[model samples]
Target: MTANTGFLERTFKLSERKTDPKTEFLAGLTTFMTMSYILAVNPNMLAEAGMDRGGVFTGTILASIIAMLIMGFFANLPFALSAGMGLNAFFTYTVVLTMGHPWSYALTAVFLEGIIFIILSFFKVREKIFFAIPTSLKNAVSVGIGLFITLIGLTSSGLIVANDATFLSLGELTSRTSVVAIFSLILMAILTAKNVKGALLYGIIAGTVLALILGVTSLPQGTVFSLPPSISEVAFKLHWDNIFTLDMFSVMFTFLFVDLFDTVGTLTGVATKANLIEEDGNLPGVGRALLADAIGTVSGALLGTSTVTTFVESASGVAEGGRTGLTALSCAFFFFISLFLFPLFSIIPAQATSAALIMVGLFMITPITNIDLEDFTESVPAFLTMVTMPFAYSIAEGISVGMITYVVMKLCTGKHKEVSPIMYVLAIIFAIRYLRPILPF
Candidate 1:
């Protein structure tokens, strides 16, 4: 091996994980393709909250690059971090627009949440919570995230649409987007069945080509590369005027709560799918991963975005044979390059990536067989964890519901000994969080 190759092997332990540079690079590319939609989506969403669109765009990329690099170099995990989808919506719709807080004020809340996360991670509080989770719940989290990802794919490809009457209904199968996504899914399935490498990546490329041919998407009209926009308007713009108020606490708590469990769920689910979890049900280097995620959130808020957490799309990489931080390093490198090639990356239609997400979802759900079905106590919470994710459209909510139900089931069945102390505390905390909306206080 060359000196550069040897250095990389020592840094990321590529051989130790049974993944070569080629496979890791391909996995990272697949992951980036599946999640590159955030480049457009995050800026657009945050702009609604009165933040500068260009600044938010730049901030999003920078934060992702930094966090992903940390994940690669520090955590040695394959996960990619970025501005979270649901948390961004809350920052825009619920925090600023609904609560009437200034955009700067909202950013402050996010910053505070990150600080708290860092402290928790430093103390290994997050790690303890992770280890405390039951193996059944962990498997269920993987299954739940699978369904959630598939739901996102279906919606993004226009195969699923919101219905005014029944909540969700199927879209026209003949539509260009849905047709392309379906074709890509089939192609990927064939490739996967044949044990082909980079199946998801090939499927996304094929789908994008088909989308262009069918006029569902178009190539960029001008030069594909350009300088990124300035973040002067949004970077370091947090406000402290409302920091001491009850409203601020509520907003920050919401950010912390969602980000905390969301990161936990993503780590649990994706790590499980990657087979990184040990026989004892703990993931090695997870504390470092949580610290990386916390740093991402803090840096994201400073740079003008919402919470930055691990993307479920990283599962696409794991599904493609990624097993080390080299995959994350590849993603970080591509994110840096994207600053100049945003237009090129943007041309990849959502329908293309949707197929990859759906395929990754299939890979993630395989752990369901590990859950004990004969035992009602274990099966009930596990089943709830699997179904609630897609139904509630929130990974954290699925985990919260699962934990609460798991605790209650164990306690009522005279099996409380099976529940860990941390699990009990977490259940009570989640219960109070849910009840806060109904509480008079």
Candidate 2:
């Protein structure tokens, strides 16, 4: 009836989702709460590579905002984008710290990978590669990523910790952080059980309130509002000299591999749940989504951060009934809000957000029941893909192994015709990835 309402509907197809702007806004807030941890965590990880912490912090936010807006308007998807967690860890711990490369060089590699991704997306090769993946493996990636997300939550919430004897043991139940996280989880479960709207959002706020009361983490001491950090230190600081060297090849390839699988896996997992997957098992506008990710990665490198990719955290929004780009647009607005409210946003301790991630993981696991494990041919590869993600601590590694095993099993079981040509190419790539450890330079 109103002009503004008509504009909103036309832009995001609100009627198709059967959702209003109010619900989409709430869903976006919920997604942002679950993923806001990256704002603090990504910069810290890059700082280990000798990056300017303040500069990285600004870069992270800028990259996320840019990518999410692209996803909202161009891709018209509900997914959110950010400097990815595992990819950043690998960029710091592996590329810069262990390999003796300067931080700028690593940043250059990320930029190159982004450029390559954009080229692939333009040619539609990225979409084809994703579509060639077997449906069983796609389902496995979803379940595997769900388990990986759960593992992250449990660790971040202090519910699980390293043990000298058993590798992982239960954290102290009496610890303030763990207690707050457990309470948040229970509260969310109850709310969800009661069919309450915005249960995840409510749970996160409650957890943060409890943390402030318990002092598991301290509140910010400075002024409530502060200016954005300067992006001068690292912006456009990429080291182009080493871009063509053989030593940079492995780093670039790893970045490319990890990002490719992570984006595909998130898109696959999220789109499948949203019923946006086509009858041919392809995601609509996936090329556009890949392009958004590529652009994010390039812009992140320019501004100073690691590879930016689609986040699995967006599933929280989808679970909350988000079905269009409006959710992503709303999330971008909150990210902008966070730029000035860092103190307030920073006070919401990791334990609070961990509860949201754990709950979303629980929501994602329901799809696993759709997978038929009765046939060993399908189950074996799927099982490897599902379990390897959490155990190996790499989504790309899980996808690689699952894809390799899927192709191998097909040939071994006399179902060679079932294998796609692209699958064979993936198998070789995975083989090369695994062999990198033993290869002599």
Candidate 3:
């Protein structure tokens, strides 16, 4: 081998992993294709919260590139990081819009969440928390987030609209935006059924084209490739004035909770697919991987975005024979190149991105099958968690109610042994939070 090839092989331990450079590169490319829809979706979501669209676009790319590199070189794992979808939804819809906090305040919460995550990872406290939450509630969180995201997509696409009578009703199905979104959703389903790579990306492109044809959106006036927009408008804009408020603490904790479970779930699920789980039922080098995720969230907040976490789409790379950090390295390179393609990504209208959000929601809800429906003790809390998120329009609320119910159900049924100490503390905390409004503090 040439010197460069020899060095890469030694660094990534390609021989020990039983893989080569070509296979790793191919797997990375496949992974990028599947998840690159984030390039179009994230900026649009953040823009709704009054952020600079161009700046968020640039920040998203930079944060993703840096995080993936860390995952490659430091963690030496085939995982990719990006601004998480459900977390971003909470950032935009719940924190900014619903709660009336400024975007900078939300950024501060994310930054704090990252710092705490780093400390927890170092102490191995994150794993303890992970195992403390019941499996049914864990699965319910995913399902709830999925429904919440789908609601966002439907409203954004004008497929569903607010009504004074029934609260929410269908929009004009004949409208151009709704038509394109429906078409894209159908196309994505067909492509996914056919086992097509990059199905969501393809759906977004087709939706954009249909929108252009229908005059729902217009084409960009400039070159497809250009210098990335300046991130000065959004970068490092954390607001500290409200940092000590109870609301801020709750928001930060929610960000911490969601990101913690999401990262652990993605890592464990994908690592299992790659057969990286050891005989002791633990993943080797997971601390480094969690550290990489923590650092990514911190950097992403500083760079102006939502909490960053490991993407489940990395399973695409693992499925394609990626077993080492080389795959992550290759995927990072693609994100670097995409920085200059802002014009193309910017022109992808909300209707097109709505399709991707809805499809992602569908993917996230698959864990619902794992929840045991026969046991009301387990199923009640899980069902409440699944329904509360979309109905209440809050991810944090779903988690709070679920925990409170789970602890109550177990205690009342004389199954209190199943509830961990950590869980009891969380349930008490959430209960007090709910009662705070009436307590005249």
Of the candidates shown, which would achieve the greatest lDDT relative to the real structure?
1
Candidate 1, run of 10 with poorest lDDT: 238-247
TM-score list, all predictions: 0.98, 0.96, 0.74
- Candidate 2 on 55-156: residue-level lDDT in tens? 898899999999999999998889999999888988999988899999999999999999999999999999999999888888888888789889989999
- Which predicted model would earn the best TM-score? 1
If ranked by lDDT, best first, what sequence of candidates would result? 1, 2, 3
Question: How would you encode candidate 3's per-residue C-alpha lDDT over 25-62 as one tens digit per residue?
Answer: 87787567657778888889999999998899889888
In model 1, residue pairs whose N, Cα or C atoms come closer than 3 Å (at least 3 residues apart or on different chains), thus clashing, are none
lDDT of 1 by residue, 1-441 (tens): 999999989999888888899999999999999999998999999999998998999999999988998999999999999999999999999989999999999899999999999999999999999999999999999999999999999999988999999999999999888999999999999999999999999999999899989998899989998899999999999898949989999899989988999999999999999999999999999999999999999999999998999999999999999999989989988888999999888888999899899898999999999999999899999999999999999999999999999999999999999999999999999898789999997
After superposition, the stretches of candidate 2 with alpha carbons farther than 4 Å from their true spots are: 436-441
Candidate 3, lDDT over the whole model: 0.83
- The alpha-carbon deviation from the true structure for residue 15 of candidate 2, after best TM-score superposition, in angstroms, is 1.7
Q: Which pairs of residues collide in candidate 2?
A: none
- What lDDT would each prediction earn against the true structure? 0.94, 0.89, 0.83
Better of 1 and 2 by TM-score: 1
